[model samples]
Target: MFQRLFITHPASVGETYFEHMRASLGTAGKLARASAACLVHAIVPGLCKTTGSTAIMALHSEIYPRRFDQPTL
Candidate 1:
């Protein structure tokens, strides 16, 4: 059960459980920062210009490429 719940997806993505946890947390951190920047931008239009969108795009590229571009040998 544990393996099915925790290990399967990570293995599919070429990561161990702990490794996947670390990477997921990193992505969460960036998303949190982006959320904050968006909140700030909402309050003051001049601040954090493109910060949120840029972070999202960067994260998307980082995640998407890694998921789809790994060599299968």
Candidate 2:
């Protein structure tokens, strides 16, 4: 059960548990930073003009190369 809970999905995505954890945490950090930039932009109107969108696009590009439909392990 623990393996299914912690390992199955990551293996399906071609990542070990630790690798998936690191990648997901890094993505979460990027999203948090982007959100903060957007909030600041909302108040300033001139700062971080493309920060949020750029970050999101970069993330999308990275995920686009991965095949979620195929099980790797």
For all predicted structures, in order, the TM-scores are 0.86, 0.85
What is the C-alpha local distance difference test score of each model?
A: 0.90, 0.90
Question: Which digits, one per residue and each the tens of the lDDT, describe model 1 over residues 1-73?
Answer: 7777887778988899999999999999999999999999999999999999999999998988777554433
lDDT (tens digit, per residue) of candidate 2 on 1-73? 8887898999888899999999989989999999999999999999999999999999999878884675444
- Show where candidate 2 strays beyond 4 Å: 70-73
Candidate 1 has its poorest 10 consecutive residues by lDDT at 64-73
Task: Please state every model's RMSD to the true fold in angstroms.
Answer: 4.6, 3.1
